[model samples]
Target: MSGSPYAPHTASETTAMLDAIGVDSEEALFDIPESVRFDGEFGIDAKSEQAARRAVASTLADNDDLTEFLGRGHYDHYVPSVVDHLADRSEFITSYTQYQPEVAQGFLQALFEYQSMLVELTGLEVANCSMYDAATALGEAATLAERLRSISGTRVLVPDLLHEGRRGVLDNYVAGSDLTVETYPTADGNVDREALTEQVDETTAMVYAENPTVRGTIEEGLDTVGDLADEHDALFTLGTDIVALALLEEPASVGADVVVGDGSALGLGSAYGFGLGLFACRGDRELLRQVPGRLVGASEDSDDRRAYTLTLQTREQHIRRERATSNICSNQAWVALRTAMHVASLGPDGLVELANDSVRRARETAGRLDELTGVQAPVHDRHHFREFVARVDQPAEAIAADLEAEGYAVHAVGDHEIQVCVTEANEQALDGFVAAVSEVVR
Candidate 1:
């Protein structure tokens, strides 16, 4: 509908409007308090379009064949050409907000498929279209955490090993929403389950944590936390890397009341580009009603024809603002479709094989690295997904710098740990990575 939201403004009209607003120039409108604004714009010269392209190409000229070795939250994976081709189909690419529900059935149906995929993956009773990403989804989940509880359950518990950015975003979302946010400390870069239990009580709204934590160490025994939240009537929300769930236990089976996670590992190219919302629950009917975003349902039209349509979309943008469950009904549909393709490409059995391959490769990589004189993951012993953190003899960042200089792409995750991510497409790269790491540490 917003074919061009800014089509009303012409260049000359914008200038005239600025002048009428009493600003000397467009730049003058940016005049902020000096304490907040830098005096200079870093003095970078602008280039012509052609010159810019050449300059950008030149910057990357020396690095055409470098193998990537980094995997913190994002990793390199094989995406089907069909994924892009299908997502770019005019039916999906040209559409937005299918409000009429009839004329917009194509987009709505694609979104419905996306939602169904998430339900299958998460094993929850229901999954909506999506949210901004796993982080914002968690923030929304935090709000639901409070709303799901009574006055006694007012505090939210976060694990020490939760992704820092996700935690910060959660804090900001709930700052004015009347809930206390606190992080449980870790024992060895992993959330201390004992500490988590000690703090969570009747006053706690949700016990939020991750497995295969940001520290690259898996947090054990969430069954205990779920039991605790049960006793207190609080929700036990497990945050996770969705792909890891293929190799690890599903949170539902392991005692989580709510399952929230970023599905980027499914196919998101980078952490910031696109995000997947992994939402599931213990399948409570009342609990499912309050869940946010788009919901797709398999239904029969009045004529008794089978169809899929957008279901419980209570987003403010779709419904009355006061009655809206979330303003995020239109989340990651195209992206979720990509995730679905990746998952469907790897069928349930295929997913298990991929998961096993990743776990084995990571374990092998750790074992080989630990054999080196100065590289090891001190915290790695449990089964892992594709990524694992290894402690180097020197600071991990410095070692990473050295590795990158040698045309390697390893990422530093902590003061002393570098992460290695293994995938089906990166076997040769992984071998080169191990050899390169050997030389660097040696």
Candidate 2:
């Protein structure tokens, strides 16, 4: 008999197994060093399922529900009841990748719609169904750019103001390749056009710029950047958020070769480590084939009825190891499904209104904060989307700590700079947020 109550084997069976394995005891199975091995019993006591659930709930109740004004990449948004209800269905929640076309048509179709919506939003021909997040999508784009035989360069140009997380991921992705990542200087939160033009050459493989930079400054001269890429035979990659895309000009109109960003803003809430990555490219077959992850397509079945299936699966698991485009094994299908359901529930006009309202609230909040004695609002003199930076006289960390004490959460980007985000979900909390800031700095 095993010592643990949870063990399945009887004493005779355990002895027989150990004898067959030529081991004296169960502890002999592991080659762990005795010095590092745990000697004490586990503190957790066995309990009923209901008791365990209540204990977990009680522990979680200790956490504070702070008002969020923080958005650099992940954002908090209004999730409609329909989105949660539809996504909570057992068939959708417990499902994995739709490898089999016959059994996964429903999920495949939902992902197809997700791709279609991204196509319309980005003005691109093809869109992949999934990616890990915006950072991974951008990293994948760097690798995809390297695949272009016509471009012989091994360098990727990124704005100096790019998000630290994104830059870190991009660095990790290109570490195995011969690609070199370099930065182009920024002028007032926008990529410096002159420096960008100077940096692009025959050795550059891609040039990436974020629409609303990490500092919440809207990037201008996108067409000029695209032209520079075209001149150097480099791919121009644009990174942005879905909400910003709804209010800004379509990426295709500015000659972007690849568009990547977060799709979670559509319906997903901010919980960290969860996001829907949006990846789209022009209708070029070569580009489509090189896109990472799966692409769902519409087709007809044996009965001549419309159907959906996974058309392109270029991940290492589906394709030959040597020919795989990416090693990314899992797709954010559930998150994508949530996004699709949220978008469908809101239609076109509702989405635009949601985006516009966010912009309005952000601008209004920035304007109000500028009136504070020690605050210099809109740190960058450029149009902002849902977030902005404010330069204050006091240390940003101290201010943030003070704000947190008052039930508010904001990001401290610099020594005295704090980034504030406004969304329809937290618009009503702006007044409280401003008052908290005033009290901190006063």
Candidate whose lDDT is highest = 2
lDDT of each residue in 1-442, candidate 1, tens digit only: 3224436977788889998998867678785887987776676666766887999999978654556756655656767677778778887767776666667767667667656665666566666547767788788888877666342577888876677778888998788677888888877656676777789787888778777676556667767777887788777788776677776766776677777776767765544336776776655766666777776677777788777667655545556476666666556777776777777777889877877777787788788888888887645566666778788878888888888887777777779878877776676776677788888886
lDDT score, candidate 2, position 284: 85
Please write out the lDDT profile of model 2 over residues 93-147, one tens digit for every residue.
Answer: 8887877788888898999998888888889998885688999999999999998
lDDT of each: 0.72, 0.86
Best by TM-score: 2
lDDT of 2 at 372: 92
lDDT of 2 at 80: 97
> What is the overall TM-score of model 1 with all chains considered together?
0.82
Screening candidate 2 with a backbone cut-off below 3 angstroms (N, C-alpha, C), the clashing residue pairs are: 1-11
Sliding window of 10 residues with minimal summed lDDT for model 1: 1-10
